[model samples]
Target: MFLNNDLGPTLEKIFNDSDSLKSLSIALGNASIQNAQIIMGTVEISNISDLHQFVQCTVNFTSLTVELDDGAWVCVGPCQKNPNFCNQQGACQNEINGPHCKCHSSYFEKYYGAQCELYSRGAGFYAVLFGCLVAFALLIIVSAVMIVVFYRAKRTSSKKFELFEDDFFDFTSRGGYGHQNFSVTEDSINTTATEVTDEQR
Candidate 1:
């Protein structure tokens, strides 16, 4: 039998009389009353016990049903049932359809997966992060090596050019005197040739 209204008064009468019912078990359905609105979910119940304590307990009943079991009537009350439908990293929200799993606010930053299981800074993230770090380090090392090589090459080239400049200056100074002697020899040869031609004429 399901009792929709007069739940509190009927339960009060049952609890007032101890001999009215025995071995009564309340299978509280998975429905709750919040702000005069009924939210339904899975069904849950409590162990068979005396109705005195249940009547005193503050339980919002959405559906009250009675069942006969072993010659005793069991009056089931509305129990707050926790379906735990939410995921490991989420909390369950009771909606019109059913319980919905929603990720916590703290998980919004890095977690976004089927059940909010994946994190942004997970293994893949670390792998890419380390790869970038290694690449940057290698770039710095390569740049340093190039700078060193360039510096050494520049220094070697400067030294070679300095040595060549010294040799060229030395050769030019020596070659100037040799060129003057060659010019003098050529002039004497020309004068001798001119006298011989005059004799022949």
Candidate 2:
């Protein structure tokens, strides 16, 4: 017989009266059994006049929560949403902490974007373009240098030819045999001398 205003003492007495039910509650509390169900059947009591009864009970279990390495707690269960929540070319994964997006393995190396669709042509294209530019610059510089060298050589050769002509003309003038009228003057002087000698004879 149990009489109490406190519900704890009344519940203890009721649980002590049933060994099987107490064992089941203990098993459920320790997480030994995950699920249970109850079914009602036709009741037959001995020497009962008018039986009217009402019973209600409430049970609570531990909430399933997981703590991540980042010190974040997340409820562990199936994702109620779609797995493809991430947009195009992206994949979604249900982690212990939460769901996240990851790029595909094919694009993992050189592709990056909101959808992992952008690709890089690597450094080779830029290297080739830079090499071509440098070659063109070198060609222009070499051509300019060659043109300058040829022009200087031609000017020096022209100066040498002019100097040789000047030297030749100076030498002919100093020898006194290159005057235009010297031969005519000498012939007239000889004619005069011969005339004078014949007269004397």
Candidate 3:
């Protein structure tokens, strides 16, 4: 509907009211400019999301001018027509109609647009990875704490056993009523000697 030169001035009016267009592409054939030069290529646009944005694209002889960043773009593609197709945001796929941009997915971001120029970084993917790392760290910490506590408790038990052994053997050093120390005397030998002499005499 937009290709008709008869539609003419309605181009600005029709596109200026873009309310729901995410992407747009236009190719002009035998399109004439009244007094100005001619454009031989297509115009492509990756517009603002859910907002009205306008860009001007024009071609004069060999010099081409178009919106580079925001609005109307006079560049078109079929993959091989432009090496930097899809703005390098995605790989270009040549279809029967033209080139289609296949947006690539990443762990941290999702892409939009045929150029894949528009994107929103997602936290969910990175959040899950970060959460796993945190969980692993906590597990390591808990394991280390348990090992230290076990070794400390074992060392304390050994010290208690040593103290118990010392206390148990300490009783042998003190005298008790059940224990006695005796002395062997020389008088018994003297009595035996005297009896032997008397028997001999």
Candidate 4:
């Protein structure tokens, strides 16, 4: 009579007790059914927390149970608020190394701005340098052309002046004097000289 009362007669009532026993059974069964082991962990405190912090929390589980059904075992580790721990392109509060951010090797983080950002080599650096070089080259080419043109022009002008001086001197001498007396006197002297020579002979 007492045993009957202790075990409830109703199926719903019995199931309520059975469910609680099944949870314990499952936990115990998981250890033997799959190869499982506990994970060890440690923590570092950068600043003392005013609120309570977790020393450790552990739960029994089958470590060998493939999570994705592809032979990869479940991961057991300390709890973290951020999910981007393993992502190379993402940042997380749970970053293993540096601050609460994770950056790819090619990137860097600025302390004042966005926690994680891509480092950029500014376009202005190349633009200014290249612009200066182009300007310098243009200046050199223009200067060289100007020097060549100036020298050629000076040489041509000097030659022209020399020609003009020679022409002026020739025109100002006897041929350009245009005097009729000078020619007549020169011809009479020539004739007198010839007569004297003849008389002497």
The lDDT for every candidate, in the order shown, is 0.54, 0.55, 0.61, 0.49
User: Which residue pairs collide in model 1, if any?
Assistant: none
Clashing pairs in 2: none
Rank by lDDT (best first):
3, 2, 1, 4
> Candidate 1, 126: how far from true, in Å?
1.6
RMSD of 1: 16.7
lDDT string, candidate 1, 1-201, tens digits: 123345555666665554443323222343332222233343333344333344432333334345445755554432214333334566655443444557654422455554456545456567777999999999999999999999999999998777667456444467465324344588899999999999999
Q: Residues 46-143, candidate 2, lDDT per residue (tens digit)?
A: 32221213211122213223423244333342232454445454665555455555754442234456446666654666777799999999999999
Q: Per-residue alpha-carbon lDDT of model 3 for 28-122, expressed as tens digits?
A: 44333233233334434233421224444332222223333454345433465576777777888755455678887787888888688888876
Quote model 4's TM-score. Answer: 0.32
Which ranges of candidate 4 are over 4 A from the true structure? 1-120, 171-201
Q: CA lDDT of 157 in candidate 3?
A: 93
What value of lDDT does candidate 2 attain over all alpha carbons? Answer: 0.55
Q: What lDDT is reached at residue 44 by model 2?
A: 50
In model 2, the Cα lDDT at residue 118 comes to: 63
**Each model's TM-score, in the order given?**
0.36, 0.35, 0.38, 0.32
Backbone clash pairs in model 1 (N, Cα, C under 3 Å; residues 3+ apart or in different chains), count? 0
Judging by TM-score against the true structure, name the best candidate.
3
Q: What's the TM for model 3?
A: 0.38
Ranking by TM-score: 3, 1, 2, 4
